[model samples]
Target chain A: MAEIIAASHGLVVTQAKDISQSSLALEADVVVIGSGAGGAVAAYELAKAGKSVIVLEAGPYVPSSEFTEDFSQAIVQLYEDKGTQTNADGDLMVLQGRCVGGSTVVNGCVAFRTPDYILDDWQKQYGLTNLTVDALEPYFARVEANLGIHVNPEHEINRNSAVLREGAKKLGISWKPFQRNIRECALTGHCLSGCATDRKQSMLVTYLPWATAHGARIYADTKVTQILAENGKATGVLAEVTDPKTGVKKADVSVKAKLVVLAAGAVQTPLLLQKSKLANSSGQVGKNFACHPSTFVVGQYEEDIHPWRGAMLGIYVDEWAHPSKGGYILEGGGAGAVELSAVTQPGLGEDFMDYMANLKKLAGIVTLIHDHNVGEISWDDDKKKIDYRVAEADYPAMKAAIASAVKLHFASGAKKVYLPTVVHAVVENPAEADAKVAAIELGLQSLRMVSYHPQGTCRMGSDAATSVCTPYGETHDVKNLFITDASLFPTSIIVNPQVTVYTLASYIADYIVQN
Target chain B: MTQNKNKAASDVSAALAPLSRRSVLKTGLWAVAGVSALAAGGFALLRPSPRDSLPVPAGLVHLEAQHYHLFSRLTEILLPTDGTALLPAAQVPVVNHIDGLLDALDPAIRQQLLTGLALFDNAAVVTHFKRFVDLPDADALAYVGDWVNSGVMPKRALGFVVTKLTHTGYWMDSQTWPMVEFDGPVSRRWGIPSRGNQPLPG
Candidate 1:
């Protein structure tokens, strides 16, 4: 523990109280902004390759040690805007982490290898001819092998997911255990709160520590406001260490690097680039954004489901997740009291209390549907603003997905299922599902969709016409400036993207090293 | 983007008693949020009002006395006042709990809460003879129900935010833990108490 702390602590540059008085300047071989999956892997690989790497993170340095069961505090710490960052229309909310490990810290540790179909689509449609399924096999293999990605054992499945499996079985739907990057999970059901057990294999306990050990420097609570450029080439970054808790700019700092990596996720990467006025020759720095927006439906049974007592998400029913025409993936979900209280259907005084009172009897399944509508990210009032509107074309699939969730819950022995899409109306009889759901319009005001996974925006492609970055994640306009996060995907991966991100980052790191 | 996650993570349990580190962090975050909101307002003044369409006060920090009262009363109605078995739902000062929760909420949500509550009666302002505060209890309940059921945005939006907040406040009430069957203390339940580096009061 002492060694871990010493190694990790020595490499981070936190903002002091008065560092904002003057700019602190430093130099590095590689400067990676945003220390989550991409930045951490890039930092580890670069540092191991004997390059001086400085990774700037816009959130605080929260170790696995700091992860607690306290629901609200975790939201305050790990989540950006307490997990309520909404789209431009303020309809669909986004859940992204603003901590050291990034969204990986707050996610359910679902390590889906980038599906072969996605790679093929990216190659055939997005002009990334080199990103063939076979070409990327080694990268995927390395990431999964390094992270110990595996399907959870049968004994590890808790009631929440067990019900999902049973429901899928009863309905004759294809279901499988979700592959996760974890070792010895205590199943405390606190994955969304930054896994406390250090068993989740989040970047905080894995590549980040390895990077720090290999001489990588991490600047926590530091916001790289601009990707400083000269002669249309990457130079460095102008940054500030903003207070994570209060959202205050605490210090001014600058980094000069030979190469720069912008792995600041989908929303922020484009905003940062726009602020820098770099890498937008394609005019796609913040366009073509896509994600799997999810709508949740919960069920209450006569027996105790103990929704918060198991792996937050385990089994997934992906029978409906087709490549095109919009489909949704159904997965078991758990929420601590705070999250449940917030996102659950709003009810009258007594009605709200009754629902919460019977929380243990409820099990929820979130339907994640691949969206076709493209959104944009822009800087509005100096804050990264996401403007996403669910396209009308995608509504049918979304509704279908929600209907499936309702059916599954009832099939799983739910006494009364509460459909969030139908304004939390109780679904007692199967007959009421279609009528109530069909009555609800599929828009921001009615559907209330959300996404933990947002992709595209600062996309990668062979052509500069439609993408901000190259096929290997290098920005088309700026030499040595690269984006290697989910932002690099020309389209949404349509699954939990942590492992996909890790794999891509590994490939990017190898690319940087080889070059 | 680097936020002080420890300060944010200071509180685990939502109990208002004893003024724990969580409360201190909440106060600190509120102060910071207040400062930022003011700065944002100032920035807004320097630029064109970025959200001119928004029906919110310029830089609302704390709730006005009447507004606070209205919010408190509405929260009581929306949440359970009658305590449940193994959980003293009645004994909890729910209004006070809602006030605390507001103090800790994101500035955006806070703005939404304030605007949603204030401009909630745009329709009423034009035609109705009574303000929300002036209405009787039954009328107020009906008014809230309309807001919840209304297809009109601000009303429905306000209803949604308040409902969520009300639910959160109720569950966070230490007395409500038994009903949800959760052991309230976070450190014990989750195993690690590493959030021990809570800041001293600012």
Candidate 2:
């Protein structure tokens, strides 16, 4: 076997360059098609259960020693489509990590349990009676304990998060620190660029390694093109081992397994099924897509904030997070020069230069809405197209979010607050905030919309005709074919999705083991 | 007098009707030449100028010389070498950075960006009476602002793409980090060790 970095303990890892042959075949009891939050957990559990497992990842294996903490290099190396994937309208930038750990490596590391109300909705509306919070508690607790997910102590809250805390205090909005899957966050503020310090418990440093320790073999730079099936049962997968830089096909890889697990995230999971032309009898494979679409507002302060000095994300405001109250939460964090520049406005030249000069004085607040499931993913020719438009009904919540941030910034002694509008609306005082936000029009290119959490493209429900997957994440039309990613979420969880993904994967692993 | 004028007109018409074959052939050739000239002029108006002067930068993998020139001019206009900026935009090698990025992008996306650049550059002829690279600094900035604030979504999107690339290219350089007081990548500075798939800190 052409393995890089000698196989130790029971793990074997093979990179693209190691394979010199034109065709390679393997056999395993279970084959996982991704190595992210979901796939890693499932692989680890199954490997520990003595099932021979093989994991195939489409991205290159990047260790922490190679992390540069440079957004430019990181974008090309770690992000999907080199950070250029956008919605069909070309307005919203869809940011997802394409590396071995998937988005868990580049995420802000915020962790949240599946809220009780969301579970209740799933049970009552979608007949997902088995997905109750009580049923999921054990899995959540186990993953949390293993990953060291905890609330940030007072010392970890930096000046940027302190800005949000102060604003919420002045405005009487409920705010608190959220749990993050980090152990000893070195305060580097480079979470979006893949933590070089190995403080963030990303799957690369956690479950993936654990799975490898338990004898799960992983193949990097392998792209699965088709799912193999026979007699209404999953048999294996057909993939190509490709060079990471030029995408030149190096070898063909085939794996035969008794069970196949599809965990390639929301967008790619459904697209894979569509390309394979399997498990689509319900016609609901790529429908009901919901992403917690988000945008951040910048507030300019008089003193230097140095927002990029500490943790990437910290405090969160949840006063208006309930459905009745518009269903959105504001998180406090800071960004690097590149990220800030992507959202900064006011034309170009001197005006933009002047804005960049205040990079040290700027504090940011991000608002994430529990957007409705009104999107579809389909293939146009050979290209993947995501047609997602924010529902017009969600306009009120978006406006309220902007106005609230404006008030918070003004209350926190801000000289000016910039709205996250394409037109670059600014409010100097709280009195003008409401009008400025009210006049903001929702257009295709009106806001800097971004989605890090894409879910529900292949939803799970009780009925065979309405949903693509059963409540246990098995396709209704195909047997022994399971999905364990955000694609299986029946509804948007309205929070960072890594924790819930791990929980679901663990829960599904138990079912798979039992059966 | 009216009768004489009518006789003169009739005589002239008869002379014209009996024209030689050589004259008719000349007229037809002139008409074809005129139509060809018009088509050439329209094509010239649509196409941007060729890469005439700038030598190709060494080791550029994806971008053509003309694409390189367009982005070089665009980066200067977007991020000038003015006193406000820490380093001159010209000194940062933004186009090279962009070229590296283009090499990493999908071929389809790379094609779209190159097309968008040409369209944006040649479009300046309508408003500024010059190509984007030939316009004065002020006019170039004004043209970019026009597109950014335009009601059309495609124009605005184009503007967004160019400006985003410019900003990313500019700020990603370590030399520009001091402008914002960002201590670049503190792992080495703080002597943080690589854990290498080890257990988490208790």
Candidate 3:
């Protein structure tokens, strides 16, 4: 699969046989540096618009047929950083995908448009004139139709989601069935392991395929190392193509394109720009890092929830999703035995074992705090350093969200409810939750906080002073270079960001075509 | 390809470090799942092979059979399976592919893991007791508790690290699935009924 392949679709997919033997290069109208939600969408959209596109993916492609149910195997194969990625402080563990489809391939398939208030804020605060909610609605509709986003039927809502839905009703909190981009989901309940059934409408099954059918060539096992620029314009990219089996760097591949679209996610996009010393004239290249820190609450119900039997997740509680009043949301999540064992709380060996013994009766809920603060990501001493500030306001928000989940579980007939963290202890009643939550110290060692949607590192704004890119996701300093991933978001949103990523990428594709 | 595994593990691990601490965390609380492994049902112990001179792994990811008896025995005590679930231990390991898993980890993590192992096996002679692997289960558990509570920085750190790795290793085993009543892939056990939530112990 090297040197190049002349596809039946009248496209040439040329790659390097040995990246190190000689320089390998190609040319395209548009060169995308990622194959995830943003890159795939932009590639497909641009290709469908009659623009030639080339996608360079950093991870090897593990076809759906080869995906396994053994999560341990899946973790190593599809996950980023050996499934051991920790926070900057090494407190919370972060899980992201590093395959051909990026995180979209391993995501839970939930889709949420960027909240209206967030779009409004971007317009008002960031001077994104054309990024109004009304302007994005059509793009959102297009993304929805393209991705097959729809509500799961009642039968698709598994026991785990049902438990959350029941608990939310008992507590009178607003909850709803989550819309997912899945086609005929078989309820494998292993979305974290990558969909083996090919039912998930991830980029692998959606935009990338569409892009491929439209002459966009995808080269996996190729990681872009530098954004090649000349005179403040992106000319192409320099990459290292690797031997997937031996993990050996086989060749140095280069792609020269008229326009370079960097959808390599929030982390790598800014990183690539930083490495090239381009697009940082404003010094906002890797700033404004906002994350929704998630806290976990597990309940042991009297009834067997069999949390693993349904769609990975189907319901979410949004009583606290409002930015003005609410700081978080509650939803159901499934953890396999290994995860349950590690996070069952009560650090005592015997007590943790007791919880594991009743695993079938346990159900876990998570609280995602819409935290406030623009954190920082930088390359320090050759290692990526994340300075994600867990704001003081975030503490009270986490407490409220967790306490609400515990109370809801009890109201829904849970015998025992616990918030799993460093100071591991069980919450017996609603009365004691706030106090217990408040007393626990907020530190990497005392509590765990993980994020799924990382945004605002390369924020798009009208001003070059505080933003890295324009409202259209084009870097203000680097012409012909665009960042279409979540990195362009001016701030955090209170929901899943996949839909927003897709919508924005489509908008960018249209912007490119129009310009 | 002898050096292939470690090189690939770190190469992919580089991606793990890609997202800023804050950027990826926004994937939403309930939108994702966590990583862990457990014992598969039916504890058919595929004991490490009895080869006298097993090929030493490039680094200390998982100890080779000849070098890992101490670590393996210690795992049994740290991660016992009794009273945990309905299914018996696997006819093979729950984490049947532990060897490859260990081989695929970053060497830095492996180094800390080996240091933890060394601290445990070495502590035995100083305390005038049998090796950690040779100690009875009850004695081993007690010693572990003491090591965690009474020791200095490195010793205390070792107890926590070893126990964590062992516990995680045990649960990650596909064999551990049945004990937890996890039916596994749809092809394997979708239509099967769950164990009664134990009749609610009225």
| B-chain TM-scores per prediction | 0.51, 0.70, 0.51
- All candidates: TM-score: 0.86, 0.90, 0.84
* Model 1 C-alpha lDDT per residue in residues A235-304, reported as the tens digit of each score: 9999887766566776788999999999888888888889888899889888988878886788888888
lDDT of each residue in A431-496, candidate 2, tens digit only: 888888888888777887778999999998999889998899889998999999999988888888
Q: Model 3, which residues run further than 4 Å from truth?
A: A1-21, B1-61, B64-70, B83-100, B120-160, B187-202
Q: What is the interface RMSD of each candidate, in Å?
A: 10.6, 24.8, 12.6
Q: What's the distance in Å from true for residue A254, model 1?
A: 1.7
DockQ, all candidates in order: 0.15, 0.14, 0.13
Worst 10 residues of 3 chain B by lDDT: B28-37
In Å, residue A319's CA in model 2 sits off its true spot by 0.9
Model 3, global lDDT: 0.69
Off by over 4 Å in 2: A1-12, B1-59, B64-69, B198-202
